[model samples]
Target: MKKRVKWTLLSLFIIVVIIRIILAFLTPGFTYESYFHLRQVDHITKTGFLNYNDDLSYGGRTLIFLPFFHYFMAFFSLFLPLTIVAKILPNILMASITLTTYHISHSITNDENSSLLSAFIVGFLPILFSTNSFTVETLFLPITFFIIYVFMNIKRNTNNSFGKSNSLWLTIKRKKYLYLYIISFLILSLTSTLTFLLIIGFGIYMLLSLMENKKINKEELEIIIFSLFFFLWVQFIFYKNSLLQEGFSFFWQNVPSGIITEYFPKVSIIEALVLVSTIPFLTGIFVAYRSLFKLKNKKSFLLISFVISTTLLAWLRLIRFKQSLAFFGIILGILFAPFYLEMEKYFQKTKLFKFKEFILPITIILLLLSTTIPAINASLKQDTPTEEEIGAFKWLNENTPTDSKILGTLEEGHLITYYSKRKNIMDDQFRLIDDVDKRLKDINSLFTTHFQTQVLSLSEDYNLKYLVLTPSAKKKYNITEFNYLSKQCFGLIYDKETKIYEVKCELK
Candidate 1:
């Protein structure tokens, strides 16, 4: 039975990986975020990897964004093409998450069937597949779960040895566990700010355990305290370097302040739930809550802690609905395993159908298919930049000087930086720069204003050398041509095939 379970789980993992690779091929460079990530990889490949500043965006300013994901990809780029690595990295990371999910769930439940079911759910859940893009969140899933697994195991080991003598030598042995826990915690906290919320969840778990047990688990408490201390110390470094100031200011300006409902639309919230395998997830939540009350064991504590932590973060708008939904899908799968197994057992004993054995597998298949098919299809069919747009970007790369600043709509800013390797006045990453509103207004005036002097003034102010008027921008601003700036003022160098235009004369 164990052998069968192992083979089945391995088969499922291989299937998931094959599907992800196919999807990666089908949708090459499908996401805008991928371009930004690819650019980072390219930068790392060129340079030695200690540099954090990206001179391509915001007119050659220092970047405060986390480089963990980029660094991870860079290591792979040594053996493979950067493009191939970027395309498949998300799938690779997610596949690891699937394996980790199985071990974590199996550790908690001690049921192989349930653990296999949980692994299947997480490996192919549509919401998770959809979010398997080139971003920090993609890598966060596996790292976060691995940390939980380590934490739970540490707690389990300490609990099993509760009566051991508190000798100096024994204390030294336990310090190794603390060291492991602290190292994992610091890795997560340093790599992504989203991990901070996971730490918050750990705190909640500790508090709830205290409420129930009337005393904190000393080992868990020590790990949590050390995690918080290191997390704050990392934040202090970011603060001292002025990186936190830039990020916080950007967040304040862009992220709306309000309740959760105000932040997410009804349709989006609905989509998030459905994408997460809604029925199974909700069922699992119910089961987890019931189990939490009935059994105060380490397994129950870890399960409920994850669910509650993700829920609180989602409720407080600390994470997006999609992200929260993805996290919930994993938890829901783990929690739903036992309930599903029970159902399977009951179905197996039924006399109404001769094929009662097929019931469990069929139900799981249907649930997996219902979500997986739509997500895969949607991912393959997702719209990316047109061929002409790609060609124009390529042209800009060849023609424009490396340091030339191009002024365009915010949409085109990052593409210019990523493809052309030139500086953009502003891009979609509005949160990273100061005075985004003013820069946005200036860009709008540069494109929309009919006055030639005003256009020249805005152009010279930002040291912009090229003007890219994409079809989308032209249609958006309702401009047929550059009516204000004539040939004498600004030479139209490359306007034959592409929507982009280059200014020939240098400004005084």
Candidate 2:
């Protein structure tokens, strides 16, 4: 039975990898945001350092971020092409969440089949279906869950050791997990600011224990305290300049107030249910409500704490939309184990007990179908650059002068820098830019307004030399053609599905 479970888990991991690799090949290049990380990896590979002072992004601005994920990609790029490393490595790291989910579910349910089902649910989770997103969260999610698994084992070992004869061996095992948890957490902290979600979840867990008149584990309390201080110190070291410069507003990452709503939009219940799948969303919520309110199921409180933390932070608009949803989906996936086990146990007492064998397969099939469609759809629908767009950028790289600056929408900013090898007036990295809000307004006016004089004045102010007008930009500004654009001022340079215009008329 154990060997069967092991092989099944291995097969599940491989299946996920194969699916994602196939989906990645459906696009010519990665999503727009991936080019930024690609550029960072390229720099790290060439210069052996991160380009913190990026000259091309936002037209020469200092970027503040954690560098561990970039270094991670750079390490693999030492042997292979950076593009291959980007497409394959992220999917593999993301798929490893299956292993972590399996262990977490097994620990809670003590049933291998139920745990396998949990792994399958997470492997195809719709919110995690971005096969082309080369972001820190790919590495961050699996590491965070591995830390949670290690932490869970530590608590379980401590509980099981009470009055046991092999106490010394148990003590050694607990120490091993303790070291593993700390190491995994350090990696997570260096990877992204999302580490705060775990730290905050720990706080909520302790508070829930106290409110319930339950004693918190001594080791858990000590480790939570250590994590809190260690996380603060590490963040201070990396973001000291921004922390002192922006003060309390640093929590917002200095995002322009005008567009903060877009970054952290409120996720509706229906939207979240569709992303996480209807069964797991409903089952997990049921399990959480039962655990907290009636059954007082302390065993599931740790997972429930995360659900609460993610919900609270998301509600407060502290976490970004997609990230919050992804984390929520993972926690709910792990929680499904307990709910499935309970259902299995309860069914054995009813007349449906005769049909128990059929139930498991049917439920698994339902989950498989529910999540698979959304996963494939999400991967196919990724906002990657088309072949025509790449051709335009390559032409600009070959034909344009070295000092040319390209104007694109916020989404196309990184693509302009990476493919065209030219300076971009703005990109999504909003940290430490004093004029971010003004830049956003100006970009909007340049694309949407009908005033030619305003466009020329703004163009000269930023030293804009070329402008890209793609179908996306047309849809964004709700204009089929720029009425103010004429041959005297905006000379069309490269024309295709994606067009580029050279800025000709100078402001007098």
Candidate 3:
């Protein structure tokens, strides 16, 4: 049974990685935001440190971020190109979600087949198939789930030996799983601020357990307290200035109110069903309801709490849409194990038991069809730089001065810096900037305005020199060309699908 489980996990990991890599290699570059991460990794590989004082981004700003993810990527880039590390390592990390989810499912259901199937469902989850996204979340997701699995096993060990006289520290020292949980939790805590999601989930679980009159495990409560304080201290150490500046808004990462909606878009029931797939969505909901009301199931309470906490945060506009949905979808996939176990139990007592052999295969086929199609569609539709855009940026890098500030759409900010090796007026990193909304509006005006005076005015204030106009920019600003272009001020320099214009006339 252990061998079967190991082989099943290995097979699912291979399949997911292969599918993701094929889709990823379909393009020459990754999605726009990936360039930001690629640039960070490259800088770290060269200097053995993060570029907190990034010279190019936002035309030179002090960046605020946790360095673990960048350093992790940089460590691998020592042996390979950063681009190769970005493309391959992220997919491998993402694919390990299968193993983590399987262990989590098996811990809950104690049925290897159901756990393996759940792993398969999560491995191909559509929202998770952003194969080209070289972001922290790739490491964040699997490590977070692994931490949860380790935490759950700690609960199991505590329950099995509650009356033992050993102290908690002694128990942790004696049992390797306890040590593993602490180490994994430390990694999760440092990986991203998203670790707060788990801490919040733990709080909610305790509250729910109290409401239901369920007996809370003392060891689990102690661990939760440890995790909470430890996580808070780590975040404070990293984000002290951000916390002081943003206050409670730090929870939103200081994103401008005007664009917060873009990051944390509301997900409707229908949209969510499509995102998480039909089977896990419906079955997970069923299990959550049954566990909460009918059975008062203590074992399932933690998972339900995480699902609830994620939904609550997403609804409150706290978590990013994709991040929340990924968490929600994985929990539902694990919940499917309990649903499957229940269904199998029911089948054994019913006359329809003869058809049980066909159930897992049919479910797997349905899940694959539901998930794989959307995954491929999303990968194809992902907004990445074209060959022409890459060519234009490379030309800019070679021809332009190193200190040149290029203005493009917000999406092109990282692309400008990464490829052109120059400054961007503004990019998506909005953590500490006080004037993000104004910057965004100015960027829009720079692209959309017909008045040369207004263009030059904004450009002068931003210290902008060059402007890039691409299909994406034109489409974004709803313009055919810069209507204010003239021989006196804006000189067309590099022209292709992407156009770069040098600002010639200085406004005095």
Candidate 4:
């Protein structure tokens, strides 16, 4: 039975990797914030690790952005080309997540087939599939599950060793487990700010355990102290990197605010059902709550922790729309394992037309299809910059100075920085810089104002060196060859068939 489970899990992982490769091929360019990360990886390859002074964005400013994911990619880029590494790394990390999901679910339910089913569910979750490209969230998924799995093992050991006299000598002997937990915590903390949410979940579990026992266990205290220490350390690094002048104000001013209603805004009720697979999630929650009071069922505590932590972060707007949904999907898979077993038993007892023989297989196939089809279709339709726009960026790379700062739409800022290796005043990564509103207003005025003086003033204020007008920008600003600025401004350096232009004239 164990061998069969292993084989089944291996097969699911292969399927996930294959799908990710197919998506990577179908969608050629990076998506969204991936360009920023690609640039960071390039930086790491040139310089050593942990160099936070990114000269590409915000006109030669420093950022305290997380570097672990980029560092990981850089290590791989040592031997292979970065393009190849980027294409396959996310899929590899995602496969690891599938394996970790299976182990976590099996630890909770001790059922092989059900655990494999859980792995299958997570492997094909629509949100996971959608974000499985080169992104930090993809890396976060497996680390989050691995941390929970380690925590569960620690709790099980402590529970089994209850009243066994945990002396200092015993603590000394068990230092390895403590080291493992601390290492995992550091990885999660250094990888992203999202680790704070995981720390909150661990705190809740510790609080619940204390309420029941009236005292903290040795393992629990160690975890709490280690987590608190690292949390403070991460915050300190952020402050120090921000030069302590901005302090926490940097984060407060930069991170955008949004309401919880924005979570999964594009997902219809049907898609939500398909993403979460309503029956298993509902059944898992029911079973977990019913088993909440059982002494041996400590696994239920972690399940509850997942639900509370993810929901709280979603409500607080700490995570993005798809990210919140993806985390919930993992929780659903864990809970669904036990629910599947219960249903299997029911089918066997009632002899319900041999339901047990086909039910699990049919459900897995349907769930996989629901997510896989949508993800592939979405990948095929994913939008990227036009060839002309890319050509304009390439021309800038060859013609402009390395440190030149350009003022353009936020949509093009990332591409400008990544492809041209030049500085952009702002980009879609608004959370990483300060004065987003003011910078956006400046860009808006530079494009929309009909007066050449205002345009020159805005350019002078931003220390602008060049202007790139893509087709979208031209259409939006209604710019033509005979525009007023064209008569007053300098000559165009590069013009593409797609009507994209790179102007070499000064504003003032």
Candidate 5:
């Protein structure tokens, strides 16, 4: 690809990202998860501390990714309302992430066309697009791509070589190779845990490296060790502080009772292996057997590394996040860019029809549909509070005092409290619950007065405020007496007419 073509692709990716950002803000993301994070952002913005819950993990570290984004909104805050910007800005940043992946993919293969294809793969992806509208998914994909891009760059250029003509591992240029590995690991720790697979790949890449200087120097070993230690230190501090401070340790449980029957059933060991390789069933078995003796040293090494590492990651994840290996599939697809380009050219030269003729259309359709179909259905099908809910939120925003805490039976408590500039006892995200056991008990207590008192006693023990009654919560948690008490003691300050009610905490 020429310089003009490269810039044009990058420019187009930026424009598509801008469009996604526009769509994200034009309407509220309207997701249960988005609202949870939006409210968390508000809590951090106002209090400069995350006090909504005592979970140490739920703090400002989310802001590391927030810098380029948050400040952009803050720069806009001279005139616009700050809360509104906080709500809209994450999606915009997500759009930028899409663009970054495209650029990175393009850089890796030195193929402008492939880069554009990967970008399109990202752009038309419905989950990725929707991810931009919220925090969790938005942060993971972009960060994952960025880390992968960094690895590819270091892989390609450590020997000071560039372009598609070379794929040699004899280039572990001492600390240059190790430095990039360490940086990739650190970035992965900061964002999503998916870097673990990438890290394993990089480690294999390092060990398989044909070191021209065969002997190791003490200095080089120390630098590599130090780089690794530094990354580990940072991750340990973050995880230990976050998890241990809340006084909980990790545990494993039996697979969900409901999972065994689903197509998504803890993607069994066998199926996961096939999915990760996309290896042609029993045909792959034959290939592995034959290749054991036929291939040269380098080919054997590369084949083994790719197969073994990918299979291990897939099996590990299939049990926990059965469908999560799809991201790994995307990475494998990108890695195939160079080889695909070769095959397309070969077929075009030999055959009557242009191999290149239908490749773009096919890739685009498959990629976009893969991403968009699920995303569109999920978006359309999701249930959120209706107009009545919005009306109630508005009413509370205008009428209630900023400091007035409310007991809301609706999930709306967190977001309402966020926008209204009040503190919340909790949000729907499990991370916000410092004591998951206690929170679960509070949830169960919703229907019975005895249970409701257990809920109220926490307020009495601390300083209580208002009780909010939503029709949804009444149906889900409580029915008669608790509803009556909520009506009598903490009378409705605002009613959404759909049966959602916000009441001031008389107990507080």
Candidate 6:
């Protein structure tokens, strides 16, 4: 009865998650990270294979990614429209990874309720644009979990002993496991930034490997070398050429600097937490120890080192930007799972009181979820962000002429340029310009009240005609800037909080 009930609940939760996940692709920002990625797919559908060029950019450009995602989207795009087909592909594919997490965690612990908890937590935890937003992180991060699941399952099964009853299952063919691991890693390395991340993750596993197991077999070591070789080779052939062409040296250039120093750490905090808590918190305490001991071998010291390296990398990212702490914690928590479970068992046998077992479990569960809630909130905030916003995008799409050169605010500029098919004097395609930040600052100042005072030449030189302004920008500036934009731009369109206007006109 308990098994049936738990399965039923898990099924229902999965159904709900699938339904809600649709919202991730439905309402969304017009443009975001790797925005050009989807645009590249759109071009390929009309054109041919990747004519990968960063020269479309005036600023320095670096190109990474083997265009696997674009190719993946191209396959699905055969049936669907370009934008929907390209944008929604990543989100849909990752749902499988979530399912993998639930199954993997459940199998490890042999706790049906805990598995259900894992699935619910994974499905519902908000990840800002990642959960739904069309971006690389959402599409790729879940696959890492799925890959880890495969390793764990293989480990679990191989540990079976050789005997009359178990011989059928305990075949422990080292070559087969080696091939699977190598192939999985090689394939994944082509798709995204898995190279650096998996190194950190597997390093954690190596720690576990050494703590109880002997030195890695030749086969396993060979698998590791092949995976590394493939990852580096792919980058060399595809990403490296593009960067060198653009005066770039390393792969990080492919990832914008602002992304790493400014945005990533901040965003990663929320992203890491949601992914970490996909498994229930307290269940590890009651179930993880048995599995850990069962898996522990002469090579346990290797496993310890792996755990320490992964923890250290995660901490490095966190110290650079503290949000990364959640992922580190989740991983360390998993590493410490053995102790947590042993303690749970010890306390249960102690039997301090009738309700103590229940209270302790509930307390731990609450604490874990709390750690991730801020990230969830952050994700939700990114989805809509602010209310008093025009996203001039909607108006620019509907109202602007096809070829009109207009000035738009940073958020809405790219939207108008892309969706409206207009030639913007400046758009938020940062890679397209030499001075990305300077353009953003100048464009932003145009919306404030004092926009007229700073850039009078824009009116005459750029033929600045149409303008889109949102309350969000108005509020961002102090009294001086707000007053300038309000007085100068003739209100061509206004409704409730949103406004649209032309700089050249006087309203009737």
* Ranking of models by lDDT: 2, 3, 1, 4, 6, 5
- Give the alpha carbon lDDT tens digit for every residue of 1-508 in model 4: 4777778788889888888777876665767467778878878898876556667777866666777889988999999988788888887787678898888888888888888888877777656665325778768878878877777766666655534476554565456555777787888887877777677777777776666664557867778778888877886776564535545544443443331243324434465565566665566567767656554255677677667777776665566656767777778777878878777888878959566678977877866665567656655555556666777787888988786887667767888888887889887655446577678777877777777667667667777778777776777668754243573364566666433333335643
Worst 10 residues of 1 by lDDT: 251-260
Q: For model 3, which pairs clash? A: none
Question: Could you tell me the lDDT of residue 317 within candidate 6?
Answer: 46
Return the top candidate by lDDT: 2
- Write one digit per residue (lDDT tens) for candidate 6, span 348-422: 777554665584467447644653464345444553323234245555667766545566554444344444445
Which has the greatest TM-score? 2
* Model 6's TM-score against the true structure: 0.69
Give the per-residue lDDT digits (tens) of candidate 2, residues 1-508. Answer: 4899999999999999999988887767988888899999999999999999888887788989998999999999999999999999999999999999999998888899888888998999988988989988899999999998998888888777455578888888999999998888888889999899999999999999999998877888899999999999899899999888887667887778888998889878888987888888898889889999998888888988999999999988889988898988988888888888889888999999998989788988898788889889888888777888778888889999988899888988998889999998888888788788899999988888888999999988999999888887888888776667989999998878888899899878
- Candidate 2 vs 4: which has more TM-score: 2
Q: What's model 2's overall lDDT?
A: 0.89
lDDT, residue 68, model 1: 75
How much is 238 displaced in model 1, in angstroms?
2.5
Instruction: Choose 3 or 4, whichever is better by TM-score.
Output: 3
**CA shift of 214, model 5, Å:** 13
Candidate 1 TM-score, true structure as reference: 0.83
Candidate 4 wrongly placed segments (more than 4 Å): 161-177, 210-216, 240-253, 256-297, 348-353, 381-388, 401-403, 428-434, 447-453, 471-494, 502-508
Worst 10 residues of 2 by lDDT: 158-167
Error of 5 at 89 (Å): 4.8
Per-model C-alpha lDDT, please? 0.71, 0.89, 0.87, 0.70, 0.47, 0.50
Q: Tell how far residue 319 is off in model 4, in angstroms.
A: 2.5
Q: Give RMSD to native, each candidate.
A: 4.4, 1.3, 2.3, 4.2, 7.6, 6.3
C-alpha TM-score for every candidate = 0.83, 0.98, 0.95, 0.85, 0.64, 0.69
